[model samples]
Structure formats: structure tokens, C-alpha cells
Target: MISLNMLSLSLILFSISAAVFLLRRNMFIMLMALELGLNSAGMAAAHFALTNSQTEPVIWALLFFAIAAAEAAIGLALLIMISRKFSTLNSDEIKELKG
Candidate 1:
């Protein structure tokens, strides 16, 4: 019932985030889309854990969230540095990164 709805919503969010991540060239937008994708995965995991009466999935989901947070922090820091150095948020314009 509710689990199905949660899973459906999670799938929708994941799809949207994936599309945003793939289609957008801005570093900040990509970072946000990545975060949204990770969060949606965590949400699905948590929902499944609750439906199955299991603790392990919930713990894994929490760990996923922590990892996502760290990723977001590092991503933002890199984005800031990149923007400072390149003066642009568009990933396509940063050709100096290719090596």
C-alpha cells in the first residue's frame, strides 16, 4: 500500500534526478541532482526496510545518507574551487581539466 507508493515516488525522483544529472552542464545543478538521486535511493531502502521488518536495510540507508552528505560536501568544495579557477559553472567550458 504505502510502501508501493513510496517506492513509486522514489522511482520517479530517481528518474528525474538522473535526467537532470545527465542533461545539465552546470556543476552546481549536477551536484544537486546527484544528491537527489542518492537521497531517493536511501528513501527506497528505508521504505523497504520498514515493510520487511528489518533493521539492516535501515542502517545501510543511514550509512548511505552519511556517504551522500560527505559526497555533497566534497562536491561543493570542488565546485567552488573550479568556479574560482575557471570562472564558469558550465562543465563544458572547463577544458583544462582534460588530461
Candidate 2:
């Protein structure tokens, strides 16, 4: 049985992750926050599924994990390129693509 506390915690984690993504100027921290957001979302889905006896949310969480893995790979590659070009991992210093 999924409790209200689990749901509330998941929401709080997701919100904090989003805030971190938005507020952090460091590219690494932002990437970590994005992962955290994905994880919290998966947790929420799983918790809801447990309450309702549904398998769809479990499947969704698996899909999310796969997508998150792909995203992490791509994001890291981009970060590497950015760092190589700018010599810094800070987003503010790596804005060469800005118009």
C-alpha cells in the first residue's frame, strides 16, 4: 500500500530537483539534478502502481530509466565538448552557443 507520505516525499524530491536544475550555474550539478528529477518521477509512478495494483507504472519506470541512461550519455558528451571548448564546466562561462 502506497502511503501519502511516500507521495509527498516524491513530490518534494521532484520539486527540489527541478529547483536545483534551474538555480545551479554548474553544468555538473544541473545534470545531477535532472537525474534526480527523473528518479523521483519514477518513484512516484511506482508508488502509485503499488497502490492500484497496476504494472504500467513499473514499465514506465523501466522506460524512464532507459531514457535517462541515454540522456546522461548525451548530456555528458555535450558537457565534455563544452568544457573542452571553454576550459570550464560552469554554464555561465560556457555560453558560446548563445545568440
Candidate 3:
């Protein structure tokens, strides 16, 4: 019923995000796609937990969201640094990343 629809939507979201991640060359777009994929996974977990009358999976989903948030923050920071250094966000353009 509604659960099936939600799961379908989550699957669609994951699919779209994966496609965008694979096809896009811009670092920002890739980061956004990665975030979309992570959020879709969390959404699916929460929906599954709710349908099954379970609390643990929901908690795990929430933790997953927190991790996603932290990842986005760090990713953006790195992206900004890279953009500043190279003056571009295209992954293909930035050849050498020396530390």
C-alpha cells in the first residue's frame, strides 16, 4: 500500500542520485548526489522500521541522518578549499591533489 509506494520512491531517489553521481563531473553536484543517496537510504530505513513496528531501525536511521549532515559539512569544507586552490570545481580539471 502506502509503504510500497514509499519504498518505490526511495528506490527511485537512490537510482536518480546514483545516476547523477556517476554522470556529473562537478564536485558540488557529485556531493549533492551523494547526499541524496544517503538521505534516500535513511528514508527507506525509517519507513521500514515504522511499517514493522520497530524502534531500533528508526534510531539507526536518525543516526544515519546525523552522519550524513556531518559528511555534508566536511564535504562542503573540502570542496571550498579545493575550489579556492584550483579556481574550479570540475573533478576532471583538477589533476593533482598534493598534500
Candidate 4:
């Protein structure tokens, strides 16, 4: 049986993620919120997989991990390049070629 508690927890997580994504003006905060949303999705997939005795949830979790890793790598690279060129990491202050 699908539990109400699980559903409520999922809803709460999604709500928090949405709020963080909307409320945060900083690029780093937004990235963190995006990660939270992806993690909650992985959690839901794993829960469903456990209940069904299927392997799909684990696969989904692995996919999420891969995606997170790629995202982190790209984001960190971008931040480094930006800081090197602009001398700042603030999203609001990044300029393309005005340095």
C-alpha cells in the first residue's frame, strides 16, 4: 500500500526545492536547490523500486548520481573560469568580456 506519510514527505521535499529555486538569487544556492530536487526524485524512485522488488529505482539513482557529478564538474569549471577572468563568483556581477 502506498503510504500517506511517504507522499507527504515527497510533497514537502518538492515544495522546499521549488521555494529554494525561486527564492535564491545566487547561482550556488540555485544549484543546491536543483540538487535537492534531483535527490528527492531519486529517493522516490528507490522507494518505488523497493516496494515493487524491481531494479529500476537503483538504476535511476545511479543515473542521478552521474548527472550530479557531471553538473558539479561543469559548474565548478565555470566558476573557476569566471573567477579567474572576472575576479568574482557572484552571478549578478559576471560580465562576458568587459574585464
TM-score of each: 0.94, 0.90, 0.93, 0.74
Q: Per-residue alpha-carbon lDDT of model 1 for 1-99, expressed as tens digits?
A: 899889998999999999999999998999999999998999899888979999988998999889998998899899999999889999888887556
Cα lDDT of model 2 overall?
0.89
- The residue pairs found clashing in candidate 2 are none
How do the residues 4-98 of candidate 3 rate in per-residue lDDT, one tens digit apiece?
78789889999999999999999999999999999889889878987998998789899889998999999999999999999999999998966
Cα lDDT for residue 92, candidate 3: 92
Query: Tens digits of per-residue lDDT for model 4 on 1-99?
Result: 464455566678878998998987676777778888887777777777767789987899899989988888898788677678878656668656574
**Candidate 2's residue-wise lDDT over 1-99, tens digit each?**
345677888899999999999999999899999999999999898888888889999999999899899999999999899888788888777655756
The C-alpha stretches of model 3 lying farther than 4 A from their native spots are: 97-99
Q: Please say which candidate is ahead in lDDT: 1 or 4.
A: 1
lDDT of 3 at 85: 92
48 Cα displacement, candidate 2 (Å): 1.2
What is candidate 1's TM-score against the reference? 0.94
On the 0 to 100 scale, the lDDT of residue 33 in model 3 is 96
Q: Candidate 3 has which clashing residue pairs, if any?
A: none
Q: What is the lDDT of candidate 4?
A: 0.77
Candidate 1 residue pairs that clash: none
Better of 1 and 4 by TM-score: 1
Worst 10 residues of 2 by lDDT: 1-10
